[model samples]
Target chain A: MNNQIEIQLSAKRKEKPSFSDLKFGKTYTDHMFIMDYSREKGWYDPRIVPYQPITLDPAATIFHYGQTIFEGLKAYKNENEEVFLFRPEENFKRLNRSSVRLCIPEVDEDLALEALVKLVSIDRDWVPDVKGTSLYIRPFTISTEPNLDVTPSQKYRFMIIMSPVGAFYKEGMNPVKIAVESEYVRAVRGGTGNAKTAGNYAAAMLVQEKASAAGYSQVLWLDGKENKYIEEVGSMNVFFKINGEVVTPELSGSILEGITRKSVIELLKHWGVPVSERRISMEEVYEAHQNGQLEEAFGTGTAAVISPIGELFWNGEIISINDNKTGELSLKIYNTLTGIQIGKEDDPFGWRVKVE
Target chain B: MNNQIEIQLSAKRKEKPSFSDLKFGKTYTDHMFIMDYSREKGWYDPRIVPYQPITLDPAATIFHYGQTIFEGLKAYKNENEEVFLFRPEENFKRLNRSSVRLCIPEVDEDLALEALVKLVSIDRDWVPDVKGTSLYIRPFTISTEPNLDVTPSQKYRFMIIMSPVGAFYKEGMNPVKIAVESEYVRAVRGGTGNAKTAGNYAAAMLVQEKASAAGYSQVLWLDGKENKYIEEVGSMNVFFKINGEVVTPELSGSILEGITRKSVIELLKHWGVPVSERRISMEEVYEAHQNGQLEEAFGTGTAAVISPIGELFWNGEIISINDNKTGELSLKIYNTLTGIQIGKEDDPFGWRVKVE
Candidate 1:
């Protein structure tokens, strides 16, 4: 282990929260991975330090300019207490992609992987044993240079923090009602929408609050230009089953390339399910519903894996899918992916990386 | 003064930079204004303290979610050493507007103005005596809650920091070459573009860098919907003088309502210049140039009251305004605005508020 990452153990451990009573991302593990980058020194001083408040100048660029990017993944535990990570490499690759778009220095993927593994291993005990609970890992980079110039910051800090998350479906997998967002535009081509940056999320919050207030679980965003084409559903990639053919929106440089979405597409392809990626329009979906061919719809992301869309409220009409119930295919995909993640099923695609 | 803003002066002062050698926003004065907000207490703890670094949990939303906004203004002094803030009330008004857009708590405008006056009065000596130098004031807010729930932070900090800035044009105000940016979108309707938020600035940095690398001083942004109508010139509101008629893009919910821009329009109207705010497209500007009707173009902002655009590069064509030199009207507007700002001109509109 010549990783050169200094480890400073906490002097006293914090009392762990009850795993069964955990919220989404409110609680954190004791230690976090820290790294610094600068123009003078590319990236140096990799260390694992006790999680505490970080000090920065009042004028740090992160507080003023939003030159920040982050990635989310999960560490799961089996009945034997064996820790596993699902497609962690994809997250680092996406992080670098986000870095190039934000003009921050691209991090070394290998070192980042090593740091994440070590950090998760040290905090392995924090992984909850509940059926659906996992340790949520957040790796983020922020511009820290203390200046008000509009250019990219010359200094940055990267850190990895872990939090214990409860089951997304505490009661059961209930399909959600979605609103077709016509007023707000989330992202457009040639924008930071493809990047996992903070600005994109910031731009979506107000709309999300409005949708939530209107008694919807999430928003299904349309393309920014014409507002006719389907782009994404909330923060997740969306898919629809029409006339026995599964279709998802193509990667058009505006919507995020979700790892879970990719896996779902692959799984459907492997199972001989007719699947295709192309431009989807809400009008076409409505037409299909009018023709009585609309079958199922769902969203995919790292947090919930498969969030079935039961109903869509668009243009003063409510379009129900599959009688507003969790589609059978959505449940199968969720179970298969979670099983592969938690070591309960055979890993045919080699998606899981086990911790030694 | 029952403002309830406790003042704590610094024990010792650092050496001030030479006013003649000051840069933009790098150096700060000895003191700053800070106020905190919480769901339970609302906004409290307003105080003026010694300038110092701030501490926050690493998971603070400002680092990851981009929930932040800011306003920029200047404090100028005449030869008599009497400090003046040009339309300081407007900055506070815009700050609250930005706050409402970002879902942050709106600050009390009267209290904010009072705080700014007191802070500037205390650091009045730091206001540069150089003819082209003045104290740059930046009032900003950051969401400081340490959570990752993809919602608005429950905690916030609003602060005001002052820095002495050198003249934007150390030499005479030379016109700048601008590149018409058609590749990226700065903002769109139903977005945070109208708000003075950090995310909008972050979204524009990469394009600005590209334009700068291409030897242009700024990028002229087009509308996100059609990618045709002119939206902004870099961070400033743009104006064009065509065939003796001054035209600018109206505030169509997707462009910032700049204070300098508003003042420029009022000044032009006061001078009885034919001015209008309407949608002006790049094709229209090019046609006007082709017909030899294009007379002058310039950008307006707090930093440079008037930044003349001498040349524009778009679609393999070069459009020159006023033969690549500053226009006479542009010069006159610059002189008038700067004159009123430095207290050398009469305040007809009562825009200048004295810091007494």
Candidate 2:
């Protein structure tokens, strides 16, 4: 198989968006990486072309069966005008894992990674140099077979689109208020919760919309079975600090294994802060708040390195964390991860892959 | 809103497939129904045009977030060449219910139904006249906004497509074997199971594929919480007759409220047969089998009408039902429903809607 990716530049380039006024996932770059997979041909004809609309049959399985999966990452530009991607190989690996769960065909990971680097390198100017601004890369796979059957499609399309996004925390990493969801569940064990599939996010919209309408930034989902154990916060994996021990829910096949969550655990262990993954319940969290043992809480994801939780509302009771301010440890970890992500800090772990 | 539906007929009509060789969802008619929805304009511009491909942005919410919902019903032709629809208004009502859960804007149900009747009337010839062949109608709504956010899209497209499909059971209404799912789950109570959304079917693909690989025609999904109580069978609602008592799992918010299931219940009540809907566990089913009270088992859906369960394999224990033959009651119910659907019997319940 030829590893080369053919490039087709856009004849009419789109005007770039202002770096400071960009919203998440709204602005697109000049080009995108695309590849197709067939049951007989595997994956072939890899190319980077001008970003455009895709035409599909009205009965395409992706539009009717939700046989789609996606991964989220970002490309950063340091002060020296160098582009770097933080562990993009991990994103491709997770994409394949999500493919297996969604019953879609997986792609060649090495070739996918190569396509990403080349695509980003071709559109390097789109990587913003401003602080807290980067090129958000979204790699997604969709079933394209024109059939309305509830089975996996024989044809698939894997594409990578980049958008220039401003910082998730526009106001200096301020914390967010979250509401505990008791009525709706995001995912349950033995479901597609662990995989980054489109259905998981679609199943979560109603609850998230309700939380937003209630003036909360996001919803803290409980386990789908008992609706007691904490699962996640919005689209990110959640973590809490209580009585000097940092804990997040163990991945019990129903929670996403967030890359940022994994990196934070590693950073905490390196700094000698006690950390563990176990089943943590909402009752225990509320009790810790009442006992004054809840020092800090935050969420981890690629979109935001750390989203500190300022307040939590459970069953009409509200508790403020760290007096509605960013905790010391949360700030430290955020800065450390962001520093390593861009080329500002020492890369002892070798997580960043340069786009050369 | 203008209730006028614009029409654009296909200039070059394609040859229709032979009725005897027709497959499910593979052969489409010449035209389709479409409507667009926007937050500013609401649902407007209903029209019927030639069947064709739909172009959408790569970042459309339907591709990345799975904000899509669909409904399925069939158009049957009588011996006198009259076309009829079975409980189509109910399908539209459920579509709005699904829209509420997925956060998509609801359509004007009355206008939508009018459009469907008009479209099917234009393509009325596509409704086959064979005994077990009809035109399967699929109405779907998809989020078309080009953004990668996890929130609901402000713009959507609702479309109706028709396909000439052969009988789900080719060689008469024979029984099938079903394997009980022990590992994967279909949905949870607080999830989007009750709604006819794309995600529910997508999540069940892996389990269904595994069951098919194991020589089972379909899978019997248990509850998501305890995995004990019977939930559904494949894409259909399940019913069992134990010791002359016909019972099915109640509407538990996780299982779909099938229209055929409702029709069966009403028919049973009209005939004074012992019928009930309540929580029925697999353990009780196994025990009923041991006691020789498991007389019949079958599934109900629009596609198959009634699919009898010849055998069930649960946790390595295989049990045959009704001597591996279609139960007498199952056949009676199938005949009654299909008879009403195709206008062979008097519409005592007024369930058939003529497309005129």
Candidate 3:
């Protein structure tokens, strides 16, 4: 409640990684933000401590029950060495939403935002300035209670760790191939699918491995109950340009409410492009492609910003779009979004927050 | 792959809890068993060390992705002070099955069983000898890789921790009231429902809390796809006696293949009772009750052994079974199964494995 953070600076900072050759989430910064919560004390002991290993009891609820939630966002450094975070408030808000679903306590968004700004400022040297490089921030909460009861935990820890990441794809902005997965389902209505919890990602690993083995970058998941309607592509929200109209899956209870997906819709609407959020089935998409109405398709997420979908493998058929190249609108949206992120373009919507 | 285990006993043991006043999973033994796995070395390091907290990087996959699996069994002590594990080999085999589903590497069942037996033998003094008590054995595997990628981890830790647990229910082996969960689904077909994974349990917490708040011991889950067929009760499998026949939901993908449930069916068959495994819908169950044919209902799991269901709350109606008392068959099953566990009865099925 006091919003005062106890800061402990690292005695020595490690040598920075080569930004040009950095791998996503493989390198960490010098300091991290941590806050603890308990039923008796609520949320307390907010601190910025040296990045290090964390100790947990052997019987902690997290190890046995997987009671955890996480949020991912990035911090960009401009040519003038000015660091910016894009729409960070939304991430914290969504984190609270996820906590509600997972039965974990909510963190004070204002305090969390303050903590992030201070942490990024203290570790500003870790933010990469190279082209297509940024600091990937991961804020996660895990149950720390040492009990085996199948119930909500009474103790928890909220932490923010950061990593310097290279571009999401090795081929830069080239299109990727995604295979449609029909065997394993990610989430369903009245489930934790919409929440950014650990279990959802865990459920997708096996299927993603299979897709990768088949030479696809990711897998497109359908609705859990029927396995017909498109829910998401890998972990990102998907969009399609059909008959010159922009359409994406509705905010179904089973699909994650991605922040970037919201921004893409707003940006399209702002540009006078017709965009709609509705249930679009895989059958409908294939039929549209058969009718030559499928124009472009891409996925929106914080990791890639915009990943153009060039080829889709479904039912043993390979459907290539836009001649297996990035769509014109996809490139424009990527450039504009990345520009706005780096403070190169005007922040018409006041989406950027400085790290100072 | 040497099966020889390195051992380091605890220098000083902690005070043992009173067997009559024990709590489930609250008091642990002095030492624990551990095995480490890496892609390069496989599962190599096998050791028994002092029970202590584990250190992990903040970015460990288990914290953010819930890449973990676990198994539960019990070790009982007879009057002769000899310890027996109730079908522990089955638990390890099921653990490997869960690993396959969660994309975790499967442990050698024989090796895991050997480690568990050895660990339990060393901690035999911790086994409670009370009428309704045993040493709860938790064998779990967690991803230890410090990476943010959504793929399966290459590093893992398998551990066995012992806890002296009292009776699962504070009221002894009495019947429990169950509320039908129609809102939050535990898991769906093609999901992690059948796996003994952390994510499945994590997804059930919020609903379990609601059930507890509403004056119910647990919630009876319906199928996620249609919410019509009976799936499970809490984390256990359920059965009903209708018209002199015992019926349970079949081994559907969304229901856990409970070892206790299997033993119960076998015991029923051994007694020449008519038992069937099929899709048991709530409507059919209610109809059977209305027709005065639903004789008994119970849940089966390792924790409770056999939990009789006395009342069901669904659609604003209370369906009281067996006059809100434990049924004859329920009591007989609980007594027989628990008797066999503690070596008080004939081990006809060879379910008990000695810790020697």
The top-ranked prediction according to DockQ is 3
Candidate 3, B97-129: lDDT as tens digits: 899888999898998999899999898899998
Worst 10 residues of 2 chain A by lDDT: A1-10
The parts of candidate 2 lying over 4 Å away from their true place are: none
lDDT per residue (tens digit) for residues A222-268 in model 1: 98888999999988999999999999999998899999999999999
Interface Cα RMSD, each model: 1.0, 0.8, 0.7
Cα lDDT tens digits for candidate 2, A136-186:
999999999988767789999999999999877777988999999998999
Candidate 1 chain A lowest-lDDT run of ten: A1-10
Model 2 residue pairs with clashes: none
Error of 1 at B18 (Å): 0.6
lDDT by candidate, in order shown: 0.92, 0.92, 0.93
Tell me the spans in candidate 1 whose CA falls farther than 4 Å from its real position: A1-3, B1-3
TM-score of chain A of each: 0.98, 0.98, 0.99
Q: How well is candidate 3 docked (DockQ)?
A: 0.89
Per-candidate Cα RMSD to the true structure, in Å, reads 1.4, 0.9, 1.0
Clash pairs, model 3 backbone? none
Q: How do the residues B72-174 of candidate 1 rate in per-residue lDDT, one tens digit apiece?
A: 9999988999899999999999999988888899999999999999999999989998988899999999999989888989999999999999988989989
Candidate 3 chain A lDDT trough over 10 residues, lowest sum? A166-175
TM-scores, one per candidate: 0.99, 0.99, 0.99
